[model samples]
Target: MTCPLIQKDLANACALETVKKIVAEIGDGIFCVLVDESGDCSNKEHMVVVVRFIDGRGFVVERFIRIVHVPNISATGLKKALETLLSGLGLCISKIRGQGYDGASNMRGHLGCLKTLIKKREPQAYYVHCFAHQPLLALVSIARNHEDVDWFFCEINRLVTFIRSFNKRQDLLCKKQVSHFADLIENELMETGTWLNQELSIARANDTLWGSYFRILTRLVWLFTPIVELLEDLNSD
Candidate 1:
């Protein structure tokens, strides 16, 4: 049961059955596609494909199609990969009424992009920049335009980098957290209960995704005193 090969086989079978059902559900219907590509932890580029359409019950449904490993992420290469995937699933490119992708040059470029290529093949396959990423992009733009906001984020990044730079510093942080929590419990400032006093680590803000700034700010507020003490201890040493 723990064999890697057997596990892979089982996963593949499950994916196949799931995709078959999705394709059946999308049968003879005009659908929209959403595509996104990113590098995995192993640094391999994989593109995710999802099909969205209204079902017989008149409810909109979105289904995962497959993840395709693409060695080349050029617009032409991605278009070919998408074409082959849809063909294998017996889905026609002409039936694609919409294309949703990020604003990456290779994806939404005016010329020689996945959007343009698809539009050329099927003129009705209109493209739209994905709505999910709009808030993050807007926030980043506003930060750049506002000097104070940008500076605050920069200082936060520097603080996280300095603390996470050395193993000894991290160890000191952990010790400070334990001591602080113990004091809180002793003073009845914090409750003593199961799962109440879990340890926390500082989170660094990520530029590409939403809520990352909020996470890092929340963590900083929670551990502000410990972080300041750690910095002072390092300065004295």
Candidate 2:
């Protein structure tokens, strides 16, 4: 336990065992693959591969199979990296029933794209743009075309940043929420139960995720009174 190398070896062993179990569950069944590449904090490109298939209980399951370093993001480079990863895992590319990738030019381009290259090998591997990105793309388009929506988002961003800049302000917000909830509970305006009226904090929005935007807006509405009180106190100070 005191040795770092030993710890790393143990972790690797656990990971390999988990992958082996997942492969046994798959049992030569067709699976859909989702592949995406992004740069790490050190500016190194890495590609993640996930496999989706139905389990013995007939429930849809998705497992992260590997994250391989890809020095190149070109169509051919990505395809080669993918093939190597799948083959190493003892998986056949021909068994792929679906391919999911983000709407990147190198991925879904009309000619000489990753999808095109994969199709040449396995015609049944139908390509679908990642659904998680659809709402993000829609929100981005709306923000560009509409002035009011874009301005609202900007103001929200400023408000969240201002509040989160100071540790004292965050503590004040949490204290105010506690007091407000107490009042509601005493007056029977709110019900108390297991997992009810959980504590909430401000969520920062992300440029690539629509769910983060929704969360911040929802928290803003839920904690409106405490937020307003916080701003008023700051103004007085």
Candidate 3:
């Protein structure tokens, strides 16, 4: 009880005072809310809420108010928590002109999503998806719309996986890299034991991350010689 009171209670009290000051400065101003949920190494769910509003000088400012530990995340729980947080700071739900989510799969679902629930509580709070995902979505769209591009990615992804799974192939790849480096040194192209920043392993591409294809292509370019020799060695084995 002593430890929790000192660490948690005292800390929360200080945070509350700071929020009160910030809210007082934004009196009667319309603000937007940004919400993101994350989990730490202990698998504890945490919700972060930020408020973006125009200050007295007409400049926009964003301030992070609270990070609450939640055992689970649900539409109702999130909405209630958000309401309580704002009300604790003497803010009105109607002042929330917008709401934003990370556009993650869990939050994007049709049923009981955070953005949807938020709008239900405050109809004026418009939903805005994260802009960072636009490029990723474009890549996914291109892959889905084009058969050739899709097949190309699938084949490269499988090839990288297969190479990584085989110990002999990985050793052969390192050997080829060593041999190539030796030649470069012998030819005075680079210093002996020159370390190329690129590692020998083939890079794996994530299906959901944006620009992973570029990563695959870049790795292929750097390891072209060693990869070719490795393939030939595997064939002769």
Candidate 4:
């Protein structure tokens, strides 16, 4: 029997086919790349590549090209990886208008960084400090310099850690959210359903970095009542 997991060759073929359609639609148009690298739980390094461009209809679009696994994380290695990726996507490096990476010293190095290397290859490609990371850097500076704000965040983070610590609590929380929604539906107090037959409108804006796990706890606190009620219902069930 065939295994349930996707075979590498087939998956790569399918991914290439999708990227082929995206490039065909983009068609020699100028575009910018947003690149970021992260380490996975398995200790493997992966790079996420996203492209932003204007389509034929004058509408802006952003699409993920792929997450590539690189054997090495050096500047030279990453630059080579990018070259191979663009070639595989059937896109010319000269058509690249911009590049973005995090505020890391290695990435933004004046001499041999990926930004400098790409610029050498295509002079028109401007290197941008990832706009989303700007606010994050600001916040980091604030947290370090400020005492009260840091303490407040630390307390909230502890609370969030407690909430997410156990699977039993998580399941109970989901149950409560469901029960609360049902209660609202039963009382005819809220419309719980809607249908969209046409295209969905998406906001075109520079998405900034939003703070991390703290938002999860903030949301949980806001929805605490319904969550409590749902958990009670689950217990009685």
Candidate 5:
């Protein structure tokens, strides 16, 4: 009673049915998407798309669904890649509630293409600029605009480079630590770079403007004077 074509069709139908069951179980909820594109050393741009949502069990989870390699960054290419990804995965665009990007012009531009294409299809897709990245951008702008502030960053980099370059300098830094030197540095500097947008602003404003800068600068001056003096002596010689 089973025709081969009918049997094959039934198998495919069951597969889709299973997918539908899962989606239904997941129910209605807002889903957040993060998309980024980057070029490798080979100059191939790869787009990665991830989804975050409350799953059937009511736990928030982020799942990476696709990493697609694209040859170019044109609007047409990006649109096609997205459409193909959604169609292949049986994902509905209407279900998308939030979109996030790293402020790439192509991703957020009013007419630069990608945003235009997406808005045409899913007008309700709300876009949010990555807040962490925005802070870094603000810092970069402040640094570039002020000369003294720029000098501060250069100095900080020089100091960091000196310590990182030689074991002796690193040991000296470790010895001067009130607690574990590594822990101190990690606590103060590791997450600092994530706020790159405010870096220049923090550097330029006078010591009186932000009292915290003095504390940070004092630490740098204490830890780095020996290395700086040595370098100066070498230059003079």
Candidate 6:
């Protein structure tokens, strides 16, 4: 099928008109804005901003209204890009009811420059830190403070890497039901901390163990003889 003749400028103008018409028809509704920045293979940073709002029927819809190629991740650059995008959409920063972003240092801050500017403009705008990011930050904190825990994670990762790298080792581990056993072990391990006399320390130790349990189980099952010998040698020591 032959493609129809299309003019780029006319296409963009019509698209913008459609968006304006839709927003006008929707009337007043809470708008959720999401902003994020990413770097491409060429190492050029681009900022994308999206707006979501509810319609008359109370159904929520999201629209990608602006994508600006920012020079950098500086506060001034982000502010300029966001301001320009909002102005072009005939949106006041104050109209935004909710905001979401990947918890970048620039995006999720209260004292940092970006959030300060945003709060100054919209005092009631709700700010949410991405949930997935919060857990990752918590994990990183735990990993940083405990040397033995960090070592266990590094070793577990190395074991997983080794198994995944070799087709035979992965197949053997799967045949031994290591994955399923690891899942069961983790469930049991969670219960272990609840009845401990030294609850807090035991829980922390169990948390580290649970985190790396699967890798250790897979390694043990796949390399059973070596693991048994290592355990025996440790006992003799």
What overall lDDT goes with each candidate model?
0.90, 0.90, 0.79, 0.74, 0.64, 0.64
TM-score of each: 0.66, 0.63, 0.58, 0.59, 0.49, 0.52
Model 1 residue runs over 4 Å out of place are 151-207, 211-237
Error of 3 at 221 (Å): 14
Q: What is the C-alpha RMSD of each candidate to the true structure, in Å?
A: 6.0, 9.0, 7.4, 10.9, 13.4, 13.3
For model 5, the stretches where C-alpha displacement exceeds 4 angstroms are 1-30, 141-147, 151-237
Which pairs in model 1 have colliding backbones?
A: none
| lDDT over C-alpha atoms for residue 54 of model 3 | 91
Q: Rank the candidates by TM-score, best first.
A: 1, 2, 4, 3, 6, 5
User: After superposition, which runs of candidate 6 have C-alpha atoms over 4 Å from their true positions?
Assistant: 1-18, 25-28, 131-237
For model 5, give the RMSD to the true fold: 13.4
lDDT of 1 by residue, 18-92 (tens): 999999999989999999988999999989999999998999988989999999899998999999999999999
> 3 or 4, which is superior by lDDT?
3
Per-residue accuracy of model 3 over 125-209 as CA lDDT, tens digit each: 8888766666777778877789898888788888898788978778878888878767776888865454654355666875446
Candidate 2 positional error at 165, Å: 30
Q: Which residue runs does candidate 3 get wrong by more than 4 Å?
A: 1-17, 139-149, 155-237
lDDT, model 5, position 163:
56
Q: Candidate 1 overall Cα lDDT vs. reference?
A: 0.90
Give a tens-digit lDDT track for model 2, residues 1-237: 879999999999999999988888887899999999989999999999999999999999999987899999999999999999888888888899999998788888889999999999999999988988887887788785798988898899999999899899899999999988899899999999999999998867875677788899999998998899989988999
Q: RMSD, model 2, all Cα superposed? A: 9.0
lDDT tens digits, residue span 1-237, model 4: 265465776887888888988899889789998888878999998888999899999999988999999888878888888889988888888899999998555577877888988898899999889877888777666775789966765665564454467666666666666666577668986565565111111111122334443455556564667556644665698
Question: Which pairs of residues collide in model 3?
Answer: none
- Error (Å) of candidate 1 at residue 81 is 0.4
